[model samples]
Target: MSDMPATPLLDTVDTPADLRTLKPAELRQLADELRQETISAVGSTGGHLGSGLGVVELTVAIHYVFNTPDDKLVWDVGHQCYPHKILTGRRSRIRTLRQGGGLSGFTKRSESEYDPFGAAHSSTSISAALGFAIANKLSDKPGKGIAVIGDGSMSAGMAYEAMNNAEAAGNRLVVILNDNDMSIAPPVGGLSAYLARMVSSSEYLGLREFAKKTIRKLSKRAHNAAAKAEEYARGMATGGTLFEELGFYYVGPIDGHNLEHLIPVLENVRDSEHGPILVHVVTKKGKGYAPAEAAADKYHGVQKFDVITGAQDKAPPGPPSYQNVFGETLAKLAETDARIVAITAAMPSGTGVDKFAQKHPERAFDVGIAEQHAVTFAAGLAAQGMRPFCAIYSTFLQRAYDQVVHDVAIQNLPVRFAIDRAGLVGADGATHAGSFDVTYLATLPNFVVMAAADEAELAHMTYTAAEHDSGPIAVRYPRGNGTGVPLPAVPQKLEIGKGRVVREGKTVAILSLGTRLGEALKAADALEAKGLSTTVADLRFAKPLDEALIRRLLTTHEVAVSVEEGAIGGLGAHVLTLASDEGLIDAGLKLRTMRLPDTFQDQDSPQKQYDEAGLNAEHIVDTVLKALRWNEASATGGGARA
Candidate 1:
């Protein structure tokens, strides 16, 4: 590490309590230095960058003004908490962020006293802050409770729900609306346009104060008339008439980067013992860094890069990522079929649907952070004779489980779900892992679940889902690059419930699902060296198990093993259910299932994570040998020889 001169104000403050000793001018210097540290740290670690950079001044102002560690401060998405984390005494370990036994990428309540509520998904801060406010009021420990949320997160319906409830309850809560006019991408929807209108209104502030002063002077008989006038004036001046109607003391459209304006406004809200207040602070995403300011979305999360040149490290060339393949394949399919449409929940570029959105602008929809709405909306589109492809990450898809069951499956709509990031995701850790989709969706009545073995298979599955006129169909693919397979000029559909046998052997059989087929193949080769002939089968569809193929394998092979890149309640559990029903266990056949253990895997590289979970080839071979009790015979070479 380079020995750059640290700012004196920053060096003296280790906690929020220490921040009180610094003067307001000194805090400005501290904010600048903090921004520099955040830029450097994230540049080295390659994690959330733009959000943190945008919120640096606001973070400093909040910690400086609020009595933190007692007065609760909640950050909505927690992607912007790097500045908060650094100032709260985690700076020394900042280099290890999002790594295996180091600091978490988001705000963790267990990690420090400063983080009151933790969040990874968007639009949760207001509810959490309200909970704290109510608790504080009930407990009689009267302190300020604040929720700092971004304009991007504000698009979700849940934020409005929380605002409505908070206003109705009339509690002393402060909601700092950090309006940068962007989420991951430039925000969409009527709410965003409304906020923009309010931000642009010239007479909004002057009219609000005039109405409040005029309302106070009116007699009891004319109070109703005063209220009516105030409402009418507010509706005309500020476009947040919807929020005021919900009963909040609305304040802002202020300059968030200017500490002079932000501090006094925050202090006024903090001191006022009023009803719920919403302070709208307009900021710029990637405020200070020039490269980041030019492209906020690209810098939102970035790879390690050079500071001076602002050039990101080039990734090694390999097979295209599964997300890219899905996007390209879907675009090609949509060219021929005008009925096909794509939908994403606030992620156009991340899910690789940006290309499709560009080509088919009229058919593409970008619903902001509202997964439930996305699913139900797709169902509606399907009902109208349009083929809707709902592209979302697996973990995020969990948010819309009820919609999948009620809207899509129950109605028997042909909504094709392209589930990206369907396995262990590296860097982002457990909260973002795509581990539970196979189990969760497989149990739904009218749903068909399938996993891709490689890029080619993913294309085939996409083609299959688009053509299938049956109920909802899902095709899940992992996060990273494919297996370097050659592309097909035209896509073809696969048999719905059929599986292919890769290698045939009589001693043991491995029924692999999804991306684990490659590992099973490698294990089969390794076992052959020890005189253990192994069979490998790729079960394409998880919901409808290929009973004939499974029965054939059970009759021919002495022992069988099931493998998947998911948890206990997934493919392995389903196979066991079949075995129990068919009385296969009573016939003296040995069985073993290899799935992720019943514990949350920690943060690590994808390769290391697979090895640790015993899902790799060497461990699979060992597990199969141990299960068959043929270890000694295999060592002596008395069984089938290689």
Candidate 2:
């Protein structure tokens, strides 16, 4: 608390209404204080930092000019909403961001009225804003729908799609393109600022409307030529011809950090009667923060850090992360096989495709924020005899399900899917958790889905997937570090649709999938202590059922339980169906399934999330005891206890 910067000006503002109460001269000081408060809060709690810092002045300007809750402001991706949150009555809980039972890392409509729409994925803000705008327009309401989206989000086609359909909302829709990457427009300066203010002003708009009316009275060809001339002339100077073509009145390339330049232009845009407007504002990522400015991506997401030195707390050394292991192994495999290639959707480092790119830059492709294209592209490559691995985060890959089904699965393409973050991810919460991949992919007819039990198994699976060319195969691994098993020197090519017995027994059987094998082994230890001879088997493949092994274990064991880190309709569901179809259930089979609950989990530690979901070792042991109907008197009776 003592290390926090003094926010004398920001302390007075609790909401946008309070921010509007301040004079125009006081805004510069308020923006400075807001930036400090954001840095301090993120430094204490350790969530997104650079994006929030980049938009500090823009956040202040938007809230100051617009009537917020009534105006309906939506932030694209919501990672930069920290500053927006702090100003909108969540500053008290700022330090609890991404923590258990604290503030979410992204915007939530339920959290506050200020957050009109919630988003975690990119490129959805424009569509959501359009929806709000149209809803208000139809109801004959006075509020506008304002969307603050970054340039990176504009890479997705959804933004343009929304823009194309925005004319229906008339003057109710306003899109602020926050260009932090400086990729779209040229450098912003005094001339551009003056031009932006002039173009958005009432006088300029009124004159333009009058000119349009006069031009409409002329011949159709002449009117069209005059309009194209005017639009292209402005486009050459402002770089907004594309947006103008999408039926929006384009303005700016203004300095986002300059309160003087930002507030006036925004005020003009607010008052103008334009049908649809796209304001381009240029701002530096990690602006005003020396350390973050030097390396924006490093500070984009962070752990708790020192505010003065900008030094983050390092996690203790542990086993290599599953992502890096997959990346390195793929890179190594690509060395011998000329056709081996890696593909990722926007996230190169997050999916470990960056390592592969380093070795085979020509073969590895980093497709920006376009999952559908990435899957189909991989499918195309696979169809032509090249072995392509489409490495993507499980939750993100959901965006390309149609492509996966139509382009790859239906055609039975040999696309190697390296699904990263395949289980519950800590801190990022339900939006980012990989809860449904196993359920979704296992249901596909021509899919081979495998889950790794440890780091070593992951290496083997990666190699195995590289070699397998029969059909579409996917290997999923969890987020964070793997179990510290030594990686195989020469990777093993495991037989398809098979499972291995890790621990042998005669009474109770624990069938594990994915990283939950560790918990299954712990449950075996607890069951052994309770006089139950427990057998723990890592059933690696979720699809194709590992039929022979599952049948052998189900018929022999007194009570068999399937444990997995996926939702309903995964391994447990398949196992239950197997038992039912084989008449094992009619023969008095005492079978139980353990899995994630039918509820979305909030942001918390991975262990706490799993504990809450009741998929831990203790829960497994309890499930086994309950299935056996064990009592204190008959606890040591083993299989006869039932």
Q: In terms of TM-score, which candidate is strongest?
A: 2
Q: Per-residue alpha-carbon lDDT of model 1 for 511-585, expressed as tens digits?
A: 999999999999999878777778999999898888889888877888899999998789888888888889998
lDDT, candidate 2, at 108 = 91
For candidate 1, give the lDDT: 0.83
Encode model 2's per-residue lDDT on 1-642: one tens digit a residue: 688899888889999999999999999999889899988999998999999999999999999999989999999999999999999999999999998999999999888999888789999999999999999999999899999999988888889899999999988999999999945885458999998998899999999999989999999999999999989988988889999999999998988899999999999999989869999998888998999999998999999999899999998999999999999999999999999999998899998999999999999998888898999999999999999999999999999999999999999999999999998999999999999999999999999999999999999999989998999999999999989999888888998889899999999999999899999999999999888999999999999888999999999999999999999999999999999999999999999999989998999998899999999999999999899887757454453455
Which residue pairs of candidate 2 clash? 170-275
Stretches of candidate 2 above 4 Å error? 637-642
RMSD, every candidate, angstroms: 4.4, 1.1
TM-score of each: 0.93, 0.99
Q: Give the TM-score of candidate 2.
A: 0.99
- Each candidate's number of clashing pairs is 0, 1
